[model samples]
Target: MTARVGVVTFPGSLDDRDAVRAVRIAGAEPVPLWHADADLKGVDAVVLPGGFSYGDYLRCGAIARFAPVMGELVPAARSGALPVLGICNGFQVLCESHLLPGALTRNRSLHFINREQRLRVESAGTAWTGRYTAGEEITVVLKSGEGRYTADAATLDELERSGRVVVRYTGGAPNGSDRDIAGIANEHGNVVGLMPHPEHAVEALTGPSEDGLGFFTSVLAHLAGTVPAGADRSG
Candidate 1:
């Protein structure tokens, strides 16, 4: 059976459709999930696309973390039964929900940033990165205001030591993120949060390159148990 990937649509979400399209292009079935719904509908994976959920009130993703859908998503993802990818504002949500560590703060420049970005794959063993090779470089769209990923020094060190730092910005830090970190994964590598909008880079005609397609395909491969040899599938 084709893998079913859920693309969640929270209020004010702007990239949910792009996420659904990316999933479909990657050969998986896209299931639309609403923030108010508590059920996951048995999807193999989930994507929280970028957007200003709840008008970015209180704080970016702070309010959306309490969404009814997250009530179900949090536990399942914690158990490593569900692979979740959070992009941009979605990344903020994951951090706010405590599904992933660290918080996304305002850009150091204190301005919204939108541009094509270069990133290096730091760990390709995760469920969402299996299609990539460690050290490979790719270009994807980066657009956000609160995009700086910050964590306590100890937490940041631990993330690096555990090989959970999924990707790092190449060239220079666009948002002044510590250590040029652009994305990270949970200890199990099942949950990944990226500051860039990978869904927007899945198609060459629209994106900087087709580099972002690997993320969706990687999850599908994880579900099918057909990831490349030597892949870490513990998640």
Candidate 2:
């Protein structure tokens, strides 16, 4: 069977279609999920695309944390039974839902940033990032206002020690994120959150580079048990 990857669409989701297109381009069936629906439709994986969910009310992803779709996604991802990838605003939602540690704060400059951002893959073991080798650099589109990632000192230390830091800004910290962190994964490597818009980088004709296709392809590789070279599949 073709792997089915669900792309959740929140009320204000701006990149859901792009994410769905990426999934199809990666050779997986893209399933559309709604914020108001509790059922997952039995997808092998899920992608939360970027956008200002709930109008960024009370904080970027604060309100979207309570969406009905999250009710199912939260527990499945927490149990390591599902692979979940959160991008941009979706990354903020995962933090708000506490699936991934830390919070995304406003950029130090307090300005909305939009550009081609360079990042280095720190951990290739996560389900969402297995296609890339560790330390490999890639460029992707990054656009966000509250993309600075912050966590307590202890949590930062643990994330580093456990190899949960999946990616980091390589060109320079555009958002003043702590430790130049751009993305992270959970201890089990089933859930990941990234501040860049990988979905927007999948097509060579329309994006800065096709570097982001790895994220979508990596998930398909994960579902097939054919995880790429650098992946740690122990979990």
Candidate 3:
């Protein structure tokens, strides 16, 4: 059966359609999920696309974190029964929801920065990154003001020890994130949050590269059971 990935559309979301298109390009059905709807529509996985959700009021994703859809997503994701991918503002929501450690703060430049960023795949064990090999470099578009990832030293250490650091900025940390981190996964590896916009880079015709397609493909592989359990590292 073809996998069905839900692309959520919250108020002020700017990349919902792009995410849906990416899913379709990855050979999966794209289901539209509303932020106000608690139902997931039986999607195999979910993608929270980038945007200025809730008008970026009350701080980036702070308010959107409490959306009705998140109420159901939190528990399901925590149980490892569902896979969730958060991109840019979605990453902010994930941090605010406490599904992932660390918060995305203002850029060191204190301005909205937009660029094509290079990231090294640090962990491929996660549901969203399984298609990538460790050390693989991929380019994705990034646009945000509060994109620096920060966490307590202890938490950062723990994430590193547990192989939860899924991706890191290559060459330099454009947003000044701790340890040059750009993405991370939950303990169960079912939930991932990243500052870059993979959905925007899935198509070669419209993006810097097709490297971002791996993320969507990885989830499909996981749902198909082609990805082995504990098969976390890709050298």
Candidate 4:
């Protein structure tokens, strides 16, 4: 059976369709989930696509984190029962929900940064990154005003020690994120949140490169048991 990946659509989400398309492209069935709906429709995995949820008014994802859909998602994700990937604004939501550590603050320049970004895979063991090799580089589109990832020094050290820092910005930090961190995963490796829009880079014709397809394919591979779970740690 094909793995069904649900893409959640918040009120202001802009990349929900693209995320669904990426899931289909990766040979998984794409299920559309709504922020207000408490049901997941029995999806095997879920993706929170990028967009300015709640107009980014009180903070990027503060409001969306409390949406009805998250009520079910948070518990499943934290318990390692469900795999979840959060992209761009969705990353903010994960942070706001405390599913992932650290918070996304505004870019040091305090301007919207939009461009193709190069990132190095720091961990390939997570449910969303199993297809990538450690140290492999990939390019994905990143567009956000509050994209800088920040956390207390102790928390950063703990994440690094636990091998949860999944990806890092290559060459330089585009948004002044500490240690050039671009992505991270939860302790059980079922949850991942990244600041770049991998769904936007899945198609060659529409995106800068097709490198981002691995993120989707990785999840499928994990579900099939083709990839080992919670073992491959970053060096």
Q: Name the lDDT of candidate 2.
A: 0.91
Query: Residue-wise lDDT of candidate 4 within 6-48, one digit each (tens)?
Result: 9999999999999999999999999999999999989999999
Q: State each model's CA lDDT, in order.
A: 0.91, 0.91, 0.91, 0.93
Q: What TM-score number comes out for model 1?
A: 0.96
- Write down the TM-score for model 3: 0.97
Residue-level error in angstroms, candidate 4, position 213: 0.4
Which predicted model would earn the best TM-score? 4
Candidate 4 minimal-lDDT segment of 10 residues: 226-235
In model 1, where is the ten-residue run with the lowest total lDDT?
226-235
In the range 149-177, model 1's lDDT, one tens digit per residue, is 99999999999888889989998778999
Which candidate number would show the highest lDDT if scored against the true structure? 4
Model 2 agreement with the true structure over 1-235: per-residue lDDT tens digits: 8999999999899999999999999999999999999989999999999998888989999999999999999999998879999999999999999999999999999999999999999988989888888888999998999999999999999999888999899967899999999999887888999999889988889999999999999988888888732246322
Native-referenced Cα lDDT, model 3: 0.91
**What would the per-residue lDDT of candidate 3 be over residues 1-235, giving only the tens digit for each residue?**
8999999999999999999999999999999999999999999999998999999998888999999998889999988889999999899999999999989999998988899999999998989888889889999998989999999999999999988999999988988999999999888889999999999898879999999999999999999998742466433
- How do the predictions measure up, each by TM-score? 0.96, 0.96, 0.97, 0.98
lDDT of 3 at 211: 91
